[model samples]
Target: MWKQLILLAFILANCSATEVKKCSDDKPFPLAVRVLNCEIPPCDVIKGTDMIFEIDFFVMKYVTKLTTLVRATSFGMTIPYELPEDVRDVCTNLMYHAYCPLYATEDVTYLFKFPIGNYPEVSVKVEIYLVDQDKDVATCFVCNIKVKKGPTGNTTVYEIDY
Candidate 1:
């Protein structure tokens, strides 16, 4: 049991931390964006695993609209993703009611878990945009992540980490 615990500790200590990639936008965003933390992703995840996303942001202005898009792709091609109808219904209502910005001074953290599936190349991208009432972007954040299979089926590749 001690050996198992030590191994787990070593793995956790040596693995690279997840990165907060730059968000590209066509127009200037009104507010500043900062990524507090991005946890490391598993090299490969099996289907049905709960892929969690935890993000915290400070609103610099009064935000009115918010939208998020999560997708998987491989070799520059789009892969489809569909949430269950029940989940979709909750998300639709929850997004508007729970997350719709009400105060400018409030610092909010939004977290969601995605049901993982067979993703090609383990490439996933998450995009989130906060817009104002004029349909203009208040802030946009995006991250593109690619997971590489480790040696021995489950080993860390420090070269391509993050």
Candidate 2:
């Protein structure tokens, strides 16, 4: 019985969702944010790997189209990263066969995969935004992440700010 209990606890901890902060006070925040294999801030991401994110959100108003915006802030500078044409369209990425034309009162989960590239080893604040067709933000959130070198590279150090 003790072994079973410990296993359950470990499973719960590993599967727990990440707590993220809202990017803007005026915009709606996601109900939950789950970064696969990550449950805490300053998530360690190795280069050449994919960071998978699952965002649970509710639509407060009808939206015919949705777009994703990703930005990384470091050293007091924010740089926007343009996703591929297919990944930029959020509607196509909705899970469970869900498509565009999301209606009010509908709960949806969006799965986003960000491919890590050859980025410098550093800590950055990542901001994600889902914009509706009207150019208004549907939901937004922010989190801190640390990028590290891959296995073949030398050890990289990251400076994190609270």
Locate the minimum summed-lDDT window of 10 residues in model 1: 28-37
lDDT of 1 by residue, 1-162 (tens): 999999999776544344544456463332322221235432244343444444455555676654444444456776545655443222243322356644666555444445565444466665545444656554455555554432455644332212
Candidate 1 positional error at 149, Å: 10
Pairs clashing within candidate 2: none
Q: What TM-score does each of the candidates earn?
A: 0.49, 0.85
Q: What lDDT does candidate 2 reach at residue 8? A: 94
Highest TM-score: which candidate? 2
Provide the clash count, candidate 1.
Answer: 0
- For 115-141, candidate 2 gives per-residue lDDT tens digits of 778889999899999999999888999
Locate the minimum summed-lDDT window of 10 residues in model 2. Answer: 153-162
RMSD of 2: 5.7
